[model samples]
Target: MGIVNVTPDSFSDGGRYTDVDAAVEHGMALRRAGADIVDIGGESTRPGAERVDAATETTRVVPVITALAAAGVPISIDTTRATVAAAALEAGATVINDVSGGLADPAMAGVARDAGCPWVLMHWRGHSRDMNKLAVYHDVVAEVRAELLERVDDAVGAGVDPRQIILDPGLGFAKNAEHNWQLTRRLDVFVDLGFPVLFAASRKTYLGRLLADAEGRPRPVDEREAATLATSVLAVAAGAWGVRVHDVRSTADALAVWRASGSPRLKTREN
Candidate 1:
């Protein structure tokens, strides 16, 4: 998957493609770059960011989503708001990438159920405004893993099919740097949920903290390509189903090379 943020304030590459034409073009480019899905986000869920109104978010994402869906790209609407998800799906998004895991808007589970689209429910404690304060976790891995299972229960109870659900461990949402590394090291914990796991660590600040350049300075988002590829390959090795990213072609190429070394060993379910 490749990420296209229509908001003006996403942590990475925001405002660069807020316009529909640019976003649509970028979305198409991702498809050409080997993205199985294109994820569109109109709201900036970057920690500490303020919320965007429904109408604005809808306007930013709907047109681009409509264009991509028309052009035959599988689109995922990145949102936690039911209203936004509904509008995006109606505009032709096939998936819901809800960072809040149905915690931000209680009604999102129903929306996903009715849409019948695959949903990506990320583990989150609270809204962005106060989520950082809620990062307290005793045994972060176990706590997050159990909480994510509870979210699966809630989503299923609200009518979403368990089969259509995927889970993400909300990295950088409420996690401290240490917690983020620990989760990455123990990604298998999330995968054991019996659903596909979408590991989205593209240009995340935690990566910068983990890896630093020659000067002992962490690379900026744009300069973190090598780090991203490192994590991507690691995640795939650990059995991640998919990874959301902004640099589609590089990761795709990197994974291809990694798999070619022993493609048969990579997961390919056979009947």
Candidate 2:
């Protein structure tokens, strides 16, 4: 999966693709670079970010999704709102990548059920505005797995097909640096839940902190690609079904190398 943030305030590559034409072209470029799916997100979910209205988000993503879909790119709407997801699906998105895992909007499950497309349920404790305060966890890996299971139950109970469900640990949302590392270190815990797991640690703050300077300053977003690539390769080795990344080509190349190294069987089912 490749990220296309059509917002002005995302932590990484925000204003770069806010224009409709630019965003669509970027999606196409990602497709050419080997992304299996192009994820289009209108809102900036960076920590402490405020929510955008549904109308605005829908406006930002529909045109881009429509154009990309027309050009034969697989698209996923990265939104927490059911209305926005429905609108994007209508515009041609084939997947729903809801970061809130259906907790933000109750209608999201119904939308996923009706669409019968893949639904990515990410582990989220709260909205971006207050998520930092909710990072408390005695055992990050166990808690995240249990919470994701609850979300799985919710989706199944809402008439959604279990086979269409995907899980994400939500690296930054409601998670501290240690929490993010713990989830990645024990990614198999989520993969063991019998659902495809999406590891999306691309250009995240946690990675930035990991590569911090001696002055205690976090590394810049663009500089985190190396760390992101390392995480992607390691996550796949740990049995992640897919990885969401900013530099799709680099990650794809790395995965190709991993595959060439014998394409060994991983812990979880390969998609």
For every model shown, what is its TM-score relative to the native structure? 0.94, 0.97
What is each predicted model's overall lDDT from 0 to 1? Answer: 0.89, 0.94
Please tell me which predicted candidate would have the highest TM-score against the true structure.
2
List candidate 2 stretches off by more than 4 Å. 263-271
Candidate 1's TM-score reads: 0.94
Candidate 2 — which pairs collide?
A: none
lDDT of 2: 0.94
Residue 73, candidate 2: alpha-carbon lDDT = 96
Candidate 2 per-residue C-alpha lDDT over 36-67 given as tens digits, one digit per residue, 9 for 90 to 100: 99999999999999999999999999999999
Error of 1 at 152 (Å): 0.6
The true-versus-predicted C-alpha distance at residue 258 of model 1, in Å, is 1.2
Candidate 1: segments with Cα more than 4 A from true spot:
213-216, 263-271
Question: After best superposition, candidate 1 residue 206: deviation in angstroms?
Answer: 1.3
Worst 10 residues of 1 by lDDT: 262-271
Candidate 2 matches the true fold with a TM-score of 0.97
